[model samples]
Target: MSVGKRAEPDPYSLPVPGLVRRVRRIAGISQRELARAARISHGVIGRIEKGTSMPTLPVLERILGVAGLGIVVVNDEGRVIRPMLDRADAHDGADRRYPSHLDTILDPEPGEWWGDIYGLARPPETFHRDRSRRDMQRRRSQWEVRVARHRHEPPPPKVPDYY
Candidate 1:
């Protein structure tokens, strides 16, 4: 029996060196930091950024993961190439929105894969998130206090006892 070999990815569809750099910038991390986080050598990261080296699939995934990103394959028509699994059933209400696919033939990355939601593609800064959460909690507690106070009031003075 003979087995078929899997086809290699098209060179044209692979992400460009600049895409990695841009994502790293957006992630607000230095090249060394990304290397440290991904547990890869900084020299490898530098070469990858410089277009002097091409990262293997695993290396690319590791770097992207550290930047809070992932890769996806898309057809020429810009449609995603993944299997259509029922997102609702799979995630059980854990965020069912899909990422937007941009048509940028000139871009190094042929397809865009957004794992995060609109307006929240990148994780927010920790301090900012903490502040916002505390404000929301305070507002909620205030609302609850008002509700409790109203519930315990003296029934509006018994409606004047004559009207």
Candidate 2:
């Protein structure tokens, strides 16, 4: 059978929900109890375990923390990978008071590239609003086109003979 242009699913994605479930079980907690401890809803835990929703990094951290575990992105050989957290701590000197170069780059300065490209360098609200608006617009446009096509197409005439 022919299929549309869908990407092949990755095997790695299958383990995440199971891992979360195992961790919660190991901690001897029910889904509702874990959700309460994690400051999220039981439905969120159910959704995460069912692979219907993808939690953000911070939310994942909180969930894992509540289960007496923490997220550790690792390679196939089990090497710990801390890309974002390490980058966030790269420039911490003995004083430990100064911000890293990333902060400067990310700050909404007059000459920053992010500001030039996005109109505001570090306003997360802008990114969130833009993403939601674009998604809604795309869905609306697709529905409109479908409705227009249906309106133009005529139904088949009633058949007099039956096989």
Candidate 3:
């Protein structure tokens, strides 16, 4: 071995081959057995275990499911990360799933959307660019703090030029 320091595996992640082998060992089943139960070709399990092929998420989940196991996402602190549920009647113009990174607004009011302005069939549930969204958030925070400081103050007098 070279004198360079060996890389250590991340505790949070499992390589596909290792994961497949570990799961099979835990279930005390042979590759053929797992393939039969998971309804995949027998060669698939062998390939996965041998690191020649990687299983898709659904296929992996199916194999694990039949073995009485499940795949769960976890953070560094080992807390479970649950998937967000889609709101009822809250779909974009194309009726597909909303982008997960942005907050989804339901039942948008008139003039609350860009799609209406352009009369596009697939007008968004529009998402703002990251910079625009951040700037808006910053402005909102500043406005909120200003309003909070003068919560009980009366409205300022109108400009003299307007009289």
Judged by lDDT, which candidate is best? Answer: 3
Task: Estimate, for each residue in 1-163, the C-alpha lDDT of model 1 and write its tens digit.
Answer: 1345879977546555887797688789998898898889999989888877888888888888876888887877999899655433222123533332211111112112232324334321111123333344545555566887666543322211111
Candidate no. 2 TM-score: 0.42
Error of 2 at 40 (Å): 0.5
- In model 1, the runs with Cα more than 4 Å from the true position are 1-13, 83-163
lDDT of each: 0.58, 0.60, 0.68
lDDT of 1 at 78: 95
Cα lDDT tens digits, model 2, 1-163, are 1225767767447566886798698888988998898889999989999998877778888888876787667765999976644444333335242332223222323432335455553432111123333344545555566886656655433322211
lDDT of 2 at 59: 80
Candidate 2 CA-lDDT value: 0.60
Candidate 3: C-alpha RMSD after superposition: 11.3
